[model samples]
Target: MVEDEFATEPFEVAWAGEARWFLQFLSEGAGEVSVRTQVSADGLVWVDHESPALSGPMRGVMTVPVSDFGHWLRLVVTPSSGDPSSLARVYLALKE
Candidate 1:
């Protein structure tokens, strides 16, 4: 089902040199779901990363990489703009 805008919990990754987000869409309804990588310092507030926003189609997957971020990271997912409905998963990969 299409969901309202949401954000993942702030994750502390100050030790990692790089991070990757894997967005997999298992099923979709209408348009598509867009994802934005966000960064935070205190893990209480957030702002978007410099990379462009991304979206995935039904049964498709999209990946985004981020670096130069501070101590915290998260993803803000939105289902507006005539976009998707349900069944999407997110994964984060960090490397030194």
Candidate 2:
């Protein structure tokens, strides 16, 4: 799920078996878009994605596939150039 507004961080997930996590997001007002993700076996320790997962001009729904099925996960939007209310408009998808 989205963790914050205009900025999402420390997204979390818990997979029962085989599952996939997807996030759909958008940016407004003409600015670069960027995404970051962090994974963890336990919620306490985190391993951030080496590079920004998503970036560039604002566009339609941007779908991001998270890591392989695991016990816990967290996805975050590292940066943006929009209002929190606007950034809050992110969508998440999952398959189990």
- Candidate models: Cα lDDT each: 0.81, 0.50
Model 1 lDDT, residue 75, Cα? 91
* Model 2 score (lDDT): 0.50
Tens digit of per-residue lDDT, candidate 1, span 50-88? 888887554477789998987899998877555466677
**How many steric clashes between backbone atoms does each model show?**
3, 1
Against the true structure, whose lDDT is highest?
Answer: 1
- lDDT value, residue 63 of candidate 1: 87
Cα error, candidate 1, residue 37 (Å): 0.8
